[model samples]
Target: MPAVNRRLVTDYDLQDAMERQIGIRVFEHDHIVHSGGAILRFDDRTVVIQAGVSDLSYFNRADCEFFELKKR
Candidate 1:
């Protein structure tokens, strides 16, 4: 992982990241809550993160404070 260049702050930003298949680490209150996951999908209220192949995690848009792109 490298320094994050973009902080996903809006629904559009999240959607774009998902569409691009960009990996992301999610943070809540400045602590990492989700890492090593691929952005599966996102909408106005929720974002889905997929870990490995079958594990899917659902997180509220409001609960996530930061979304940082992970370098491939």
Candidate 2:
């Protein structure tokens, strides 16, 4: 995990990430909730992340503590 300068906090931020095809890692406190996933889609309250080739993970926007953009 490299250093990230920006954190995705708003829906617009997530939208930008999705459009840019950026990878995101979700965390709750110091624990990782999701890792090495790309933004597949997002709504007002939830975000869907592509976990693997065919796996998708859903997360609530308010439940996530942090969304870190991974530098590829």
Candidate 3:
């Protein structure tokens, strides 16, 4: 069988932040959490989630895996 894809309002916020130049906090899988400044860039296939000062991680959005924005 093939896979299905979907996007949520939160996902839109993520893309919007990337486009509008707004920094946001991200809660990812494996109990990983990143701050607003941690987001580096976004592309068609993945989002660059950073950690510490220079450590960055790539996350694929197609998995339909959900993440939350930390409360301001």
Candidate 4:
């Protein structure tokens, strides 16, 4: 009789060390603007972020709605 070896595929938890890094910053205030179809009154024309979708039509720019950040 011979022994058999088996490998597991769906029982692994991958983690990265860089993903758990955080740093502190000194700032009095900050502001950000995006083109995600939002409105604001006290942001000095800074628009709010809504969502992110994938359709292969991204403008590939920093001021586009594709990379907008939203609050959870």
Candidate 5:
């Protein structure tokens, strides 16, 4: 885990914010909630997760993971 961007999204809008982003990382220990999609990882920067699949966390709820936009 790294320093997450507090300004990324509020607790009330986490899901929506992640949906909008082209690439976002949703970490899960058991089953991969979201997958089979394209993701972009910059040089020591952010990861973009393209949507259009099952919302893993939503279906089988879990602890919310932190994230950042990753400024270069």
Candidate 6:
């Protein structure tokens, strides 16, 4: 049987990553992907990310296969 319920990150982890100003890589498709300085915000269907120093990028949550947030 396959797992039904899976969580990528908790609320606390999100907050901590933001506070620490860490980097994250969001994997969308097998060949299409993007990464950035850190995650600004995320919702049920989308994520707002910081691409450059003062620029933000938006990605669809449904498109992501996985995401990685830096430890520190």
Best-performing candidate as measured by TM-score: 2
My TM-score estimates for the predictions, one after another, are: 0.78, 0.79, 0.46, 0.14, 0.29, 0.61
Task: Return whichever of 3 and 6 wins on lDDT.
Answer: 6
- For model 3, residues 1-72, the per-residue Cα lDDT tens digits are 553322223556666655654444444464444444534676566777655577776767553243434324
Task: Residues 1-72, candidate 4: write the lDDT tens digits.
Answer: 553322111112101111221111111123322223211111222222223333112221233221212223
RMSD in Å for candidate 5, one decimal? 10.2
Task: Name the runs in model 2 displaced over 4 angstroms.
Answer: 70-72
lDDT tens digits, residue span 4-71, model 6: 32224655655666667666666766753766567788777777778687888787767764345433
Q: After superposition, how far is residue 14 of candidate 6 from its true place, in Å?
A: 3.6
Winner on lDDT (4 vs 6): 6
How accurate locally, in lDDT, is each candidate?
0.77, 0.78, 0.51, 0.21, 0.39, 0.63
Candidate 6: give its CA RMSD in angstroms.
7.1
**CA RMSD per model (angstroms):** 2.3, 2.4, 9.4, 19.6, 10.2, 7.1
Q: Estimate, for each residue in 1-72, the C-alpha lDDT of model 2 and write its tens digit.
A: 566646798878888888887778887666788877789998878889996899999988777754656554
Clash count of each predicted structure: 0, 0, 0, 0, 4, 0
Candidate 2, residue 27: CA error in Å?
1.2
Could you say which candidate leads in lDDT? 2
Give the least accurate 10-residue stretch of model 4, judged by summed lDDT: 9-18
Q: Candidate 5, which ten residues in sequence have the lowest lDDT sum? A: 36-45
Q: How far is candidate 1 from the true structure (C-alpha RMSD, Å)?
A: 2.3
